[model samples]
Target chain A: MKTRLMVLAISLASFSGVAMGFDFGKLLEDRLNQELNKDKKTQPATTPPPAGSQSAAASPPATKQKVDAGQLGFALFGDYSPEEENRIGKQISGNLLGAVPLVRDDGLQRYVNLVGNWVALQAGRKNTTWHFGVLDTEDINAFAAPGGYIFLTKGLYRRLNNEAELAGVLGHEIAHVTQRHHLKVLKKSSLIGALGQAASSKAQGSDQMVQNLIGNGAEIMARGLDKDAEFEADRVGIVFAARAGYDVWGLPTVLQDMAALPAKDNRTSLLYKTHPHPADRLAALGEAVDGRLDGIQGKELANRFYKIR
Target chain B: MKKFLIPVSAFLLCVSAASAWASPGTVLRNEQLFSQPTSGSRVEANVAKGASVNILSKQGGWLRVTAGRSTGWIRLLSVRAGAGGSGGSGVGDVFGAATTRSDPSRVVAVAGLRGLNDEDLKQAKFNAGELARLEAGTVTTSQAQSFAKQSGLASVNVPGLPEPRPAQPSSSWENN
Candidate 1:
């Protein structure tokens, strides 16, 4: 009777162990599925949303997540976070302010912000804190830093014919921010790699390395992005402007105006150096605007622009 | 001087006329042409996919096009920018023609500018105070919306167009 009782007890213990093992396996599988679903939801942050579903409220949380993860990793490496881009943008923007003076016109600043923010809201990543500033310089130029900071020179501002024209230029700069053009250039230049190293290493030299990266980034911004990026900005800029109810021709008109200027003018010198030739830009924009945008009748708002100016 | 002025005026007229002429484009998708640029306007016609139209004018996000004598507005995103049924040569031809005008002297002059150059960037000091001030100037999204409403800028639902591929090799500015 004692031997039979012992055998029953051993069998019961083995049965309980197998049941526990099966439960553990199920738990692992469930957890993995949950993680995979979470990843799938978050991965489309960079891709554009489908048409007719572009409402700002309808945008996925992945965009917000991507922006918040700026400190994490290369966005291309599945870790490039917008928060990281914002941090880098802030640092570079600070350096830029040191290089140029800001235009302190309250009304003008507000006008630019209204226009810029309106257009930026139309973008896929609409949550960025888009800031627009007018630099108090006569250089006919505009610059975009990552993280939605855009600057336009007073010269460029004064040259614009109307609000639609202004929107076109701002839209172009905004495209750079939306597309993260400067950030891509920085990434390709080993600046981001150095930054990664700086973040990982606790050495004293890491600070210097980071500073160097910023320096290089500032240099690239001043030098201008690669031509592909500039053209893309022009293309995307018009779309954004058009999307925001501005005349789509605003960018092309501005490009034509720029092209008509002599190549040797100092006002255009910096702009010319940093951008594709106005003619090339014009032709490219011409192609973009010719048929696709021709039928779109957007608000020119010339009188309102004049009032603001 | 009079002779020169005449030739210049004629050349300018030619340029203007060339620019003013609208290029023909084909519809990439079945879309409705509205009487006005807005979507709420009366639908003038249903433009089928692959339809040909002479793109005449633009009103915000809509295009005024002529498709088979029925002139009306179509969404700008519904049409590709060239005449060919397939992707056309507009971008390629324009870029090819533009590459020949590169002037080396103008490039050198641009390199000599003072602020925001490579050396200036290298020597740039970070100004956190200025950055903070700039950030403070930002308008909230609500403020922007109110401003848009005040400005009569209605939020139109223009379909997002596909990103155009880089039509040219990186221009001369890349080497700088």
Candidate 2:
């Protein structure tokens, strides 16, 4: 089981090099055979340890090998193209919307897009178009998908006192996309995650191939990326907000508010599940920031902050 | 060990116990507190790591704090506002989410609202209309630029932060 996982990790890590010169197919074939030989004696394949993850390594190789012999290696090891990333993001976002639709207020949605786009403009990913949504749910959390889909719950939005804080929050989510954090998590499961687009509505815009890559529903969002990924987003996020000329303290202040909330707040249930404690995040951010941001004189624009009814 | 971060603004009060003159904080590192918020100012006191200080006020990236009898300004990041201190150890975490990871069945619904769960996301089906609405709301870069300009939110040239050094639990605040 360990050897099988190591093969997957190594291939995933070295994927970028395949286009440069490495014979990825041969490497994946060799590694697959080795993994198969090692796991040959082991009973059915072990599931991915991180519960709720839908990944190829978790599937028994015996069944996968027999069902589709040729495509297995590339399907499991190849990196996603930009187009593929967008489609995957769209499917995930569509499903997420089905679960909880976007906030009905057009003004709020437009305002978020404006703020999100402003923050993302500094993110350095010019080729990708971004989509920002304010989900109506009272859940106090934000989410990012592979492409450029970013969502923050209305509950979280209500907590902000200014556009800078909103920018800070948006900055964190934008960082997730710029850093390709969701894609990193999706890459693992992309192999087995494709439970087919069977459950999806045969709607006008849905892509079957992307559906197969994401697994059932939008479970990937629920599964979440690891803690390290979340911390990385926080680090990248504050910078994005600051680079856009907003107060860098926006994100940290939001963390302080979260830290002060009662332990039983249901709004934060999903957030704490996928992220480190707010206090821990603050400490981590403190390490990366310390004196580095002192020179910046950014805006906290408390007056321009839009109030929600 | 109660924290008191009384911000000048009423909305800035994060905790109900914040009725005092100043907020409490934990010093992340053993650093000098300057007489002014700037590092070029005269050093007033050298505070040790893990020491408690009262955060009197804040400037851009500095906080005016009083440590013991000595009072001076330190880098804002140098102090975390709370009695829980670094990592909020033993402090009320304000969320029961992490525990649910170990046992999804252990979810406690204290907030009355039926919060989002893994099952809902897992069982969700696509809604193309909503996705269309989301995309329709996308603002063009130029549009976003104008919107920012309206609020005087111009783009700036801030350097990216360096990843924390020492890969294993890098923050010094956590060491203590």
lDDT of each: 0.62, 0.72
Best of the candidates, DockQ:
2
TM-score for each candidate, following the candidate numbering: 0.59, 0.75
DockQ of candidate 1 relative to the true structure: 0.19
The list of candidate 1 runs beyond 4 A from truth reads A1-77, A191-210, A306-309, B1-116, B162-176
Across all models, the iRMS values in order are 9.4, 4.7
- Candidate 1 per-residue lDDT, tens place, B1-176, comes to 89699647645544464479765666756678887877778897898877888777655555677788576787655665454342223444333322343356754665454434556554555666667778888998889888778878876666554555655555331232
lDDT tens digits by residue: candidate 1, A1-309: 323322332232223235543444334334333433444432323333222221222123333233222222132222235665666677677767767768877888888888889888877685589888888776788989888889988878877888888998998999898887776666444323322322222222122333434444256566677767787888888888888888776876676456544445556646766787655565455455445544567888888783434
Question: What's the lDDT for candidate 2?
Answer: 0.72
Q: Model 2 clash pairs? A: A194-A212, A263-B94, B4-B23, B5-B23
The TM-score of predicted model 1 comes to: 0.59
